[model samples]
Target: MTPPQVVVVMGVSGTGKTTVGRLLADELAVAYAEADSFHPPANIAKMSAGTPLDDADREPWLDAIAAWARERVEHAGAATSSPYGVRGVRGVVSCSALKRAYRDRLRGAGPGVFFLHLDGPPELITERLGGRQGHFMPRTLLDSQYADLQPLQADEAGVVLSVAEDPESIVRKAVTALERAAGADNGSGQATG
Candidate 1:
């Protein structure tokens, strides 16, 4: 059997990471997690107040999320006992792992932790962010986020999908890429979870 997969759906703000990650988890029959939920209240407060989080402010949050992913990978069964686990299955998470170091921290959780980068034009993302409501991340921060993002290297075990297409199509392409990477035979894509 293939090893369990821990997928980190990563992108700048408004790239549909949450939406795509959730759908991909559902398609893979696994749990979905939101990395934003793990952020400390202080971090949220800073972001809500229009201040970009400095690396110092983000370390704890990143470590916490990585630990959560680690727990899921280590204890494949009885995942319900902890939010960190996936309830007897694999899982996906939406995270803005903007740097290689951040991705490396998450990868420490397991060998199968793969990243999926959602790439799209700035105008497209701006439009999407504008239509959203009540999100703490302001569209004004997108430029800062873009400036901070370090694209995944070619050697990394991950795939980047364009976000210009419709949501369903994007999911389909991601699942296909993941399935091919995992070498699974199931229709939805290989069981990376």
Candidate 2:
């Protein structure tokens, strides 16, 4: 049996991380998490109010999500009470993870943790954000997100997937990318993609 995978579907806000992440989780039959759900009320309030969070404000939030990832990997191959029942110990989470440092922090969670970066033009993302409703992040913060976004570096264990495709297509590509990464894991206890 293949070992579990912990993947972070990452990108700027409005880039469909949650949509694609959930779908990807379903495709992989893994448990899923939304990084937003781990935020403290203060962070939500801040974003809802159009305030972009600084690194200090984001530290704890990142730590919380990282902890969740760590816990999931630590318990790989074990049974857990979850809505997704009897999954293959794999885990997927949606997070902005706009910076390399942020991605590194998440990677520190555990081994075999990889990322699926959803990227697209700012105009496209802006349009999506404009049509969005009932979300804490405002369209105004889109610029900040774009500015903070650091593309996946060479050494990162991940792939940069475009958001130009439909959500289903993106999920299909992500699953394939993840599978390739897993298969390429070369026994170094890390994802090689």
Candidate 3:
């Protein structure tokens, strides 16, 4: 059987990472994690005050999320499942992993970790942020997030889904893409493993 998959729902702020990630987790029948929960109190306070976190401030937070991912994968290691019906011990996380280095840190968590990048126009995201309430990440830092965003590269196990579609459709697309990626990786001569 294929190993369990850890899907990282990644995007800049206001791209519906949490909403879509929760629905995706439900669809896949996997445990869900919110990356914001891993943020240190100081980081949260800084963001709440409209301060963007430097890489120095984010390393620990990213490492915490990586540790959580590794723990979940380890706990699910012995679980078995067939190719049909219920899948492997899947897990989903929503994170604003806006740079390649950050994504590399997440990839280090374990095997079968893939990314689902929710991407859309800046205007659309800005509009969504304006309407959102009670989030530490404010609209003021949107530009920095965009500047930091580095799309999944050729070697990455991931797919980019447009936010123009509804959440259900996006999740569906993600599942299909993940299945294809797993298949490709399992086939002969596939470089991804």
Candidate 3, residue 62: Cα displacement in angstroms equals: 0.8
10 residues in a row with least lDDT, candidate 1 = 79-88
Give per-model CA RMSD: 5.7, 4.2, 3.6
Model 1, C-alpha of 61: deviation from truth (Å) = 0.9
| Alpha-carbon deviation at 130 in model 1, angstroms | 0.8
Residue pairs with clashing backbones, model 2: none
Candidate 2 Cα outliers beyond 4 Å, as residue runs: 1-4, 78-89, 185-193
Clashes of 3: 0
Pairs in steric clash, model 3: none
Global fold similarity of model 2 (TM-score):
0.88
lDDT of predicted model 2 = 0.79
**Clashes found in each candidate (C-alpha, N, C closer than 3 A):** 2, 0, 0
- Candidate 3 Cα misplacement greater than 4 A, ranges: 1-4, 77-86, 186-193
Error of 3 at 71 (Å): 1.4
Per-residue lDDT value at 60 in model 2: 95
Candidate 3 minimal-lDDT segment of 10 residues? 184-193
How far off is residue 101 in model 2, in Å?
Answer: 1.0
Candidate 1: C-alpha RMSD after superposition: 5.7
